[model samples]
Target: MRRDEVQVTLLYVFDELESDLGGTVSMREHSQVPESVTTIRDELRDSDFQVEALIAEGNPADMIVGVAADRDVDHIVVGGRQRSPAGKVIFGSVTQSVILDSDVPVTVVSVDAEGEGGDRP
Candidate 1:
């Protein structure tokens, strides 16, 4: 990040039920902010970056792209985890949807199961 003014929005989206066909489901009902989001914000603040934290509930990919568009952000950075080919086919990736749908440039930070790999600025 340049020394010039820059604002970073740290957004975390909670998954919501996809359909009403199933009986009432309950889990993750509360809207508490995730510790991971707070930790990331703290790290960014420590690095002298201005940060805004936002929590949303919805389809992750849609929410991410909507926020970026609504906020008019210059770029989007999303984290993804590696999965087996079968798993990938079974659980389509939110990151992939955001990459395909986002108007702004997207940077994917992919990590392994051990969280050992990712590109960093």
Candidate 2:
């Protein structure tokens, strides 16, 4: 589909416990408005797509699904971390749950590395 025709909604899941505890969390601080949504919107400003952002409390998977269903979004984009074998089993994968539960198509992007470069456009 054309960029302009795409209806994209970015869901940022924040845990209140983490925020309240004052831990060194990435999404809790940097993604208050959901950085992914802002980045995509700014990048695609010239395009015809409509970008919306939602920050919700609770688990990421449920919030993502809820927003997708409510917005009737054509696609849902979520940012995730690439976990190690042990980490995957221990923490599980939120991206997996979101992809499985979402009514619409979901795209998971990994941005774990610092200097790693990829073609965003």
lDDT of each: 0.82, 0.68
Q: Can you tell me which runs of candidate 2 are displaced by over 4 Å?
A: 18-37, 114-117
Kindly list the per-residue Cα lDDT of model 1 for residues 1-121, writing each as its tens digit: 5732789999988877655797433334866665666877888888888899987777889999999999999999998897778887998888899999999999988766653455556
CA displacement after TM-score superposition, residue 117 of candidate 1 (Å) = 6.8
Q: Clashing residue pairs, candidate 2?
A: 4-48, 4-49
Task: Please list the residue runs of candidate 1 whose C-alpha ends up more than 4 Å from where it truly belongs after superposition.
Answer: 1-4, 19-32, 112-121
Strongest candidate by TM-score: 1
Q: RMSD to native for every prediction? A: 3.0, 4.4
